[model samples]
Target: NRCEYCGDENGPFEIHHVRKLKDVSKGTEKWKQLMIQRKRKTLVLCKTCHTDLHRGTLPDNRFAA
Candidate 1:
């Protein structure tokens, strides 16, 4: 597989949620409402690519947060 963002080899890549789970899981019906309302996105990324995305060093991509 290839890193969805950079097109680099994605060996043992991980599925990453665009939005943080903690924020997604707020504490009430609002959370459920948000889940229902929003189109949650995820990415299949290699460890290095994943790290870069979080560190804000990589250009944004559709698959990345």
Candidate 2:
């Protein structure tokens, strides 16, 4: 499977979830916005992407991080 955020075809992936619309809106990151725009509650991220997301930094969608 590939990462939903970074398009990584590797393993060690993590699923990041946002349960609340308000909480999702509070985030301005591209990934977060994507989740909101698609009306999804989860994002499958590679290790690097997951780390970047927690650090408030993530690369653009469908890019290799």
Per-structure clash totals for the candidates: 0, 0
Superposition error at 3 for model 2 (Å): 0.7
After superposition, the stretches of candidate 2 with alpha carbons farther than 4 Å from their true spots are 61-65
- Each prediction's Cα lDDT score? 0.54, 0.78
Question: Top lDDT: which candidate number?
Answer: 2
RMSD of 1: 7.9
The residue-by-residue lDDT of candidate 2 on 1-65, one tens digit each, is 77887677876899888777678887767887878887888888888888988887676654543
lDDT of 1 by residue, 1-65 (tens): 77655566736686667465455455343322334355455556777766765675644443432
Score residue 52 of candidate 1 by CA lDDT.
Answer: 69
* TM-score per model over all chains: 0.48, 0.79
Over 4 Å off in model 1, which ranges?
20-40, 60-65
Q: Cα RMSD (Å) between model 2 and the true structure?
A: 2.4
